[model samples]
Target: MFMLKQQKAKIIDEVTKSLSNAQLILLTDYKGMNVENITKLRDDLRKVDAEYKVMKNTLLKISLTNVGLSIDDLSGSLEGTTAILYTDKDPVMALKVLYNFIEENGNIPVVKSGFFERKFIDQAQAKEFSALPPKEVLLAQLVGQIQAPIYSLHAVLSGMLRKLVYVLDGIKDKKPN
Candidate 1:
């Protein structure tokens, strides 16, 4: 039908555009998830600037071509209901949100695969990536770790100077006329 064709075209356009801009693209199985649940998940993803969409696999393939990505094995995973999760920045945030959603919902949704920096990731690798900390938290922890040695050195040096000053003050106080 005309409607189906039009929808396919629109989806191809969207997916092609997404592939060009997104830092990461993730595929998921959203079979048991209801519309309300999907809406909530979309809201959660939006809060962190990730995009979520359900699209036809054929359209996805066409779009993949536009973005110079090809997958020969995607047919197996493309059988069921499929949705894409993506972000232009902070791939880990998008993966984390999806992982948390699945964890909270007892696996109502499943991660199929992901593409990050032109590299494809299987479900297990995607899960591992998601298990890592968020970018900001990881950055903050790294900064703290890097600064800790400097802070300790400063404290030690200051303590020694303070002790030397106190020793000089004590000698001055005890000086005989």
Candidate 2:
């Protein structure tokens, strides 16, 4: 009994630390995934600086309170074999990794819910987040969007200059020396 309590306390401490530093905390229910699959998922998540841990919901709830984050909206998804996937950096990249895992693994590891940037997102919303493009890709798209107008302006200006040159050439040709 004492050992179990100690383990729970340690988990609470770790979860508290993780939550305090995380930009996003995703809850997954890996009910049917095997150990090999879970390890692969963990390695993949590690590439994006995210971590996956299976913890007791009670300990997690205690840890949430320790980190000063209310677990009010997370209760609905608390049941089952839960694994916490969290990253201190880009949540979108982390979500993309998780999404890829779910996609490749035939969706066994289900996305339960998420807390991102101080907002409680449900399963649908978590899935939506996973569907998002990576930060670099989105940023690149924005840059392309911004540059399209500039390229058009350049094309218009070049056309005007070409017309001016043609006009000057026509005037010179019409003149007799």
Candidate 3:
């Protein structure tokens, strides 16, 4: 019992450190998952540079308090078997990745709540948001959209210049003839 308590304390400290630097923290319930499934989930998360771990809800609450975070809403989410995910990268992308994995796997736990960009997202909102495209793809699409006008202007100007050059050549040839 003492060893388990110490271990829980260490896990809380580790989670606290992760939360300190992480831009997002997601809590989920993994009650039905087995070791193999959990390992697979962890590996998938690692590919995208996120960390997943299990910890006692009480210790997690202590960590949140220690960090001066307001976790009142998170209290309800603390019930039931839980796992936490943290990432220093864009929190949205992390949520997106995990939620997508859950969607595909079809047998894991469900997301309960998320802390992202200083806002709390409920399970439904988290699922909806995570289904969207990743950050890079969204940024690339935005850049392309922003540059469309410039690209079109350049094309139009080039076409006009080509026509002008063709007219000038025609005039020159006729004059010499």
Q: For each candidate, how many residue pairs have backbone atoms clashing (under 3 Å)?
A: 0, 0, 0
**Better structure of 1 and 3 per lDDT:** 1
Ranking by TM-score: 2, 3, 1
For model 3, state the Cα shift of residue 173 in Å: 7.0
- After superposition, the stretches of candidate 1 with alpha carbons farther than 4 Å from their true spots are 1-7, 72-75, 159-177
- Considering every candidate listed, which one attains the maximal TM-score? 2
RMSD to true structure for each model, in Å: 3.1, 2.4, 3.1
Q: 29-85 in candidate 1: lDDT tens per residue?
A: 899999998998999999889988887777777787788876665656666788888
Residue 22 accuracy (lDDT) in model 1: 82
Q: Best candidate, lDDT-wise?
A: 2
Write down the TM-score of every candidate: 0.76, 0.83, 0.78
Error of 1 at 91 (Å): 2.7
Give the whole-model CA lDDT for all candidates, comma-separated: 0.84, 0.86, 0.80
lDDT, candidate 2, 72-106, per-residue tens: 88887788788888999999888888888898999
> By how many angstroms RMSD does model 2 differ from the true structure?
2.4
* Positional deviation of residue 127's Cα in model 3 after best superposition, in angstroms: 1.5
Against the hidden true structure, what lDDT does model 1 obtain? 0.84
